[model samples]
Target: MHTPEHILIINVTRIGDTLAATPAINALHEHWPQARISVVGSPHHIEILQNLPGVVRVGALTKNSALFRGWLGAKHFDLAVVYNYDQALVRYALRVARHVVAFRQKSPAINRRLYRCVDPDAYPTVHITEHALKLPVALGIRGANGRILYRCTPDEVDRAKDRLVGRNFDGKRPLIGLQIDSFPTKSYRDWPVESFLALCRRMLARWPQAGFLIYGGPAEMPRTQWLKQQLGDSACLFAGLLSLRETAAQMALTDLYIGVDTGPTHLMSSFDIPIIGLYHPRHPARSLGPKDHPLNFSLDHPHDAAPSSEPQSMSDITVDRVFCQVEKALATRGIS
Candidate 1:
């Protein structure tokens, strides 16, 4: 196969899904060092792709925007790899690129048009990162690393530090970031608020100067506000105040991150900070936890051993189990 000058990678999904595709993107860059890699992702979460190594351009493309793309434009791309099964995106890639690689779509005709149509089910992998890597692997491109990539500008980093200083978190030891809930649709993944309160109480007891950075969207305000009220002066609420990019910048400053299996958790994994991610039974740590992270202490629900048709509660994971991992993470950093 000839080396391509320009490559377009499309993943119009949520933050976690978008981040899952980073390793694949990295593989493509490593294989063809001179390729100008352009990414199209979800509008709300596309900022996460900004400043990633080897990716020259990042943009948002929704199903609506994909409708009009490639109609008047020349076929400028040498190759395009799409992670989405959306026919519109694949068709757009087909129109604009000489060769296109994507998962087999529902339409046999569309699959025939792809330069390489990968069957997702054929490669049954335990982890989503590996599953996403299969797309690049189909082109004989091996992954450079398992870790997800993210970069915050120096200005953004400084602003985050300034915000922390304004909140008097300058000298606070172990500035822990908390992602209290998943999205509304996946509320079952959320650990009980009571559990978080218990964990915070334990953390405060251990490190009196420990501060909490509460992160969430507006939809999770009630839970985040309650946590803030419980933690009092020790917690700073950034739930509804900061933009996604701003949140990522602030996340880079944290000493530790303890969250559910959500987008921010995936984003936090990109950093070198210690993280304790709680997973539900359905989405076990093996499938969604941080990969190749030295400080990852992810816990899975007890019900993971016994899958049932009934909905499982995340509360099955006791506060004690999580605090034990917390102690281990802090001890590794010589904070204890």
Candidate 2:
């Protein structure tokens, strides 16, 4: 086994998958403490993982970005770990690294050359965090903790604090964070907006002083606006207003989170806060759930429905089933 002096991790997936790769990155750092590590991923998510331990730098990857043809290519990394199947990224790794690791690819067999290989498709039942750590484990790097991870710089956390301080929330009252809408592409994962409004109403009835932070992106402004209007003065909108890191930093201050199975929830999973990830049949909690977290108070499709089968409606989740869990998570944290 070669001890790498410089390592490259190509994880060009979105926020959730990028956060899922943290355990593998952590393991790589533990085993090769002296190796300088660089991670290249989606432009939106790279900033979230930039300040992590052992990460020398974070770069955004794209084909026309003059990427591998530039300074990144100049660095001859001793090892490269490819986490996504994007052929462009794989080709870039092959050009700049001496040893490459990745999942097995189909015919025309570029993945056959990998020094270490694990088929992610082979482990359908395993958590994504476990699946990611498999790349490092296949290289004989053992005992890697497959927990989900994230970062919030001190300044970022203070920014969150400032937002809260302005609200003048009672310190004892719970501060909740909500991500009402999922990414447009995964809109099927979203629960009914009425269900969310009902859940908030129930929480408010219990703790009138309780505040909420509603989160989403520009694409979700309409929905966010509607929710802000419903929650009124007690709720604040975070969608399209903060950077990805800043959103996470602000989210870190929440006492609890209730959101669809989306990227920002990955940020919630990082903090020691309570998470209630609402999942529909199209996306079961088993496959893409919150990484087996201790605070994972997730609810799958209410009925025992087949995940592979397309559902006629994604609104099957009931407000009662959700409110009960929110109450339960709060009670455990002594917020009741």
Candidate 3:
């Protein structure tokens, strides 16, 4: 045990995974309240986690030279936690820390012989947040209260409202937010635009007084437009419009959110908003479901991926399957 006062976490996963890892970060902070906890991530996620409580620093891995790894290696971290156990990532941890802890994934023989490891069987069975917290749990470190907190100040909330109201979204109506894009390479996580349109159409028919807001970043604008074409003037498309902070504030007021397994779905988890989380088999319940959450509805493929099996895509998730989960989510939240 290093009695580590300064620590670093290396998580090369997406925005959702990085956010899910927060419980572990908070646990580490609780154990060493005055210690500095830093994270190395891509520039985009650095913005999300940088100013978070307990995070002392955010270092960029995407920018800087390949030799920057060598430079960071000299920082002499007291401890390092490697989330996704790639050999290159493990090697980085080994160089930076005197004590390196990693998940015990089946790896090459050389890596199997190297790192202090934890088996996955001992962790919480529900939600990625709880699963990540197991790293601290295995070491007897007390974890934070299993709540996902996004502290949006009243001013931020007011600003978000002002922005949305400017776009004619009155604060009174039930706001249902939709996320339609997954990463392009991971298109299997997406529900077809027409399917989403159908879901929205059903919601509108049921709740004519409600308003819908569609969310996505710049990369997703084209799909957002296609959804808009399907929807016509029936809904508001805020795609590529709000900053991450503003998006959080705006989503806080939402009556419900429907989307595939994406960043905003994880963000909405923090708000306690009822969510219809559409997932492919690619994102299993074991690692990425909502936690202690007020209302979470998920659609997952029954089949698990095998070495010989092809990965399942979002299109495999039928409109009817998602609509059933949506109705369940609304019922759970007592929205109707």
Best by lDDT: 1
TM-score of 2: 0.93
Candidate 1 local lDDT, residue 156: 97
RMSD in Å for all candidates: 1.3, 2.2, 4.2
Backbone Cα, N, C clashes tallied per candidate: 0, 0, 2
Q: What is the lDDT of residue 324 in candidate 2?
A: 83
Score candidate 1 by lDDT.
Answer: 0.90
Better of 1 and 3 by lDDT: 1
Better of 1 and 2 by TM-score: 1
**Model 1 error, position 129 (Å):** 1.0
Each prediction's TM-score against the native?
A: 0.97, 0.93, 0.80
Clashing pairs in 3: 188-313, 188-314
- lDDT value, residue 73 of candidate 2: 40
Model 3, 1-336: lDDT tens digits are 757888888887778877888778878888878778888876676566656677778877642322347544364778888787566777667777777777886775535644467766543346678767767776678646665555677898898888777877774356788888878888877878888887788777777766778899989998898887777656788888887777888888777888877888887887777887776665764456666677777666656444126766566667777767767766756766
Q: Show the colliding residue pairs in model 2.
A: none
